[model samples]
Target: MQDLLGHLRSGQVCYSTPQGAMISGDSLELLAQLPANSVDLFVTSPPFPLLRQKAYGNEDQQRYVAWLTEFAKLAKDALKPTGSLVIDIGGAYQRGLPVRSLHQYRALLAFVDDVGYRLAEEFYWYNPSKLPSPIEWVNKRKIRAKDAVNTVWWLSKTDDPKADVGKVRVPYSKSMERLLQDPQRYYTPKDRPSQHSIGEAFGRDNGGALPSNLLSIPNSQSNDAYLRACKALGLSGHPARFPIKLPSFFIEMCTDPGDLVVDFFGGSNTTGRAAEDLRRRWLSFELDRAYAAESVVRFIGDQAPAKVLKHIEQMTNGQVLAIDDSA
Candidate 1:
């Protein structure tokens, strides 16, 4: 069959090196082709069904959920018993009415539950720049809401999923330090402090504290940190990108060196970049050929110590990482 992307736009695979891999095709179909129980981590944000219009888009809400469900099952079967699935999904808005995002979650949760995958934990990637919602004034009463965040649902197949929370943990404020001193104080802990939360806290020194779910990292579109990190790594910009710190934190928290990381959507290849920077092997898939080409360029440019494509040639074999998956 003719490649959909090929007919629309030329698609190219990049970085045959073990450190990076990219493919151009339908994400769901591509994911199906992957080996089962192969990846250690799967991180991605599938396009939301809200803005239901695209050139080559399949943005129908029910269809989107169904599509995701089919792959979710395959992902469950393909993931290592300990592998983690990190998904980011946007909520919905319609005709001045606020829509609950749980629909996506509900459909996804059903599959994960049916597969018997354990609900390990979840993270909220708060977008502080999100637009505010409208309010209705009824007989002097008022209501106001903001579109300020997206949820990062972290899932695992087993109860003891692999996570090095230290990777995601940020530092405590001076006030937190002073407050912790008084163990008996009745304070509402610092908006979910890292170590204070009931989860794995990786990267903490003897004196360092854990991080909170209310992450302060803005999306890469608005944050210079991603560009800075990419520049330091020797790559260019990817607009639909997440800060390296986000994925880097996950690498630190859930994975070790020589582990395998996969990002099916692979939008800007942020996940793969993070994996390589941390000394782990990565494989990514993107339906958009243009983005896939950019991923390769970015990977090679940043991974090579010098501006030499020859260095990428040195990478042949990829190390494999393992994860736990449940029903």
Candidate 2:
């Protein structure tokens, strides 16, 4: 891991494990310094362009496309020929109006048409636990339904990126399981109204059903270890953190073990933790030193609150805390 990231000598290493490291610095500068074509997957949930500014900071709707495309241009050069870049961006409503902003779509086009990235695929993340937002539209006047879906753009440097749907398959539905049990008796192989022919291959159980583009993951994390550690140390956790499942899904599908994964906007370092668990080398960059230091809680297991606090202090004081996995 050190050999791969030794070039990043400028940024302060907040902490590190055998698999990856968390660095505190400007992501744009850090990203530029990375060796060209070294990263396998660059997945991140950048701060959304919302009507109200978030504590973590966000680009306004007007300049959001330009701001994000700058990063995309750099990431394109950093990615390997067969690498992938996955971005999870939430939709926003127009100021004082119920209409939705098209910034997300515009950014997508800029990444492909301008920055030379290919549109590998698009995904919609449905967060069932999301609360009804823009209360004036959804709760008070009831003009628009609750915005529960986020646009996840999967961009690639080349036409043929490294991905395997089999790696991230879901369990078969109940009806499908029944059909698989007795294909000849329960179902007939015939052409459907869609003009697609059903063959004997449908009966074969391929471990699990292929997952769809629409991912349903709940983001209701209240008592997780990261949060608990933050509470114990009297530090506020990063406000907007996507669930672990979101990054884990793409990590499993897009890259193999030992592949390099990077998240530029590493809020709470969720992507780093996910990659470490999967045995993939990762680097997470966050601008705020405090957040980067506090993120160490995600890696350390069941240490005393005082010990965790001590580690965080060391990181905040520009000391590198090498994590002992055996502990």
Candidate 3:
């Protein structure tokens, strides 16, 4: 296994695990080196195709689709037959127009039609804290509603990927809780108005209710350890950091502890940190060397981790970042 992963660690190495490695390089080049049928869970939020360009590179609409489709083929090869690839993609607006871009929609089609990956399910991420986007049309013109939702596509190698909904169930609603308390009174079996039958076993406690495909999570990070550490080192945090909850939900649902997780476009390495905390081995690739190096700060705890300290030294050219009590 180590020999197969040699190419993954060819670039600047920030961290290492039994089945994980973090390398700094273009993901397009790095992905090819990974052994086929190795990764169990692949997750990432690549730079969205925006009307205006972001500092981090993002190809224009049609080109982005072509690039992503080609990359999807490589991503599929890196995954096991029963593995899943969960991607969080945001919608884009047409240049200087109120109309929406079909790039995201077309990308979805290419994933199925071109790449042959099955769309297991589509999830929506509602970021309550998201600021108004496409400011011209949304705020100035007041033509469209606030663009606060992102599409999360769950694509799998096969019809059934390794997923367990029970692993990511949520707490039951108050009505369901009351029904569980007294099945005879509140939970009698009956045919519902929606033409759905309520079975007697519905009252059984299955940990919690299965969460809706739509996820409500805020992306704001005020004074977390990662931000504190980055601030102390004068490193601006990754502008587009996905909330930890977003990846944690899918990671729990699609993978088990010790499974392999890969983030091909590892901006700030949020997916890597989530996998680490979940005890799942992870491999990550980032194009930006500085961002890749600064990502090690996510590992700092109460005390500085020796591994991260060493990585910081390399990233800063021997300027060790102090992961003191502030973080």
Candidate 4:
């Protein structure tokens, strides 16, 4: 169980705290520099393949699958045999058409069929609070409904990726709990309409209720430190920021304390923060220097007058905040 903190090398170091470091460079380059089989988990939200170009980095539909395929090889090379790669890719439209883009599906297939990674499991992140998008289609034309879900693909280098369901279990319903006390009285062990047998011990509490693959985690973070800092400093917010809970679920289930986690696409550095808060060693890479510099604010927990002021001081370092940031 050797720690890979010192082992990570590459890119311009924006800043480093005791928890982890964020590299200011291309993620693929950083992936190449890391030793083979060094990372325990690769959880990231890469630039989604959108129909329209986004201010934040994202690939166009025509070349998205091929584009993402290249990174799959690099990511596979860096992951340990027991490691998992959890990706959160958003849904996209077909520009003028009322159809949805299948790049997300195609990219998943490419990662598995081409890159030699196994499909660990598929999870969906349902953002209940998502605003309506694609004004022409969803809002104006009234053809499509609000796109609120993102596909979280869990791809593993090996068949047996390190995941414990017990760690990420949810609470059970009151009726379900009551039935566990006396199974025979409440329900009989018989076949149902769907021909699925209802076993007597079905209600057994294995810690808590198993979580569904359709995760209902709303992506709302108005009072969060990272967003707050970005706004006050006039640094444009990383538009596509996933909630902390999304990464938190996968990290706890797939990794242990001191396990090495990497976020190749460090936009808001949410994955790194989640890993650090959970005591997992992490490394992050972002091509944008400003975004990378702003990411440091998420790491600092020292006493400051205001959180925004703290972020500005940390970003500036009281000067131009210049360094040999090129890795």
Best by lDDT: 2
lDDT by residue (tens digit), candidate 3, 1-327 = 356567564555555544455677778777777789988989999998886778778788868889888778899998999999999889988886788888877888999999999999999999988889778778888889999999999999999899998899988889989988998998679999999998988989888998999999888766256776777666686777888888889898999998988898887888887887787888778787777777877766334456555666676462333332244
Q: lDDT values of the candidates?
A: 0.60, 0.91, 0.80, 0.80
| Candidate 4 residue lDDT tens string, 1-327 | 124534545576666655577767777778887889888998898898876678877988899889878877899998999999999989888888888999989999999988899999999999998889988888998988999999999999998999998899998888877787776677777898999887856867787888989999877666467777666566666777888888999999999998888998898889988998898888888887767777665655332437645454565442223222231
Candidate that would win on TM-score: 2
Model 4 C-alpha RMSD to native: 4.3
lDDT-sorted candidate list, best first: 2, 3, 4, 1
Which 10 consecutive positions of candidate 3 have the poorest summed lDDT?
318-327
lDDT score at residue 13, model 4, on the 0-100 scale:
65
lDDT of 2 at 302: 69
Clashing pairs in 3: none
Candidate 4: global Cα-lDDT? 0.80
C-alpha lDDT (0 to 100) for residue 182 of candidate 4: 72
Each candidate structure's TM-score, on Cα atoms with residue i matched to residue i, is: 0.70, 0.97, 0.90, 0.87
Better of 2 and 4 by TM-score: 2
After superposition, the stretches of candidate 1 with alpha carbons farther than 4 Å from their true spots are 1-12, 52-58, 133-144, 177-205, 220-239, 300-327
Native-to-model Cα distance after best TM-score fit, residue 88 in candidate 4, in Å: 1.1
Candidate 3 TM-score over all chains jointly: 0.90
Candidate 4 is scored at a TM of: 0.87
Clashes of each: 24, 0, 0, 3
Sort by TM-score, top down from the best: 2, 3, 4, 1
List residue ranges in candidate 3 displaced over 4 A: 17-19, 223-225, 301-313, 316-327
Alpha-carbon error at 117 in model 2, in Å? 0.3
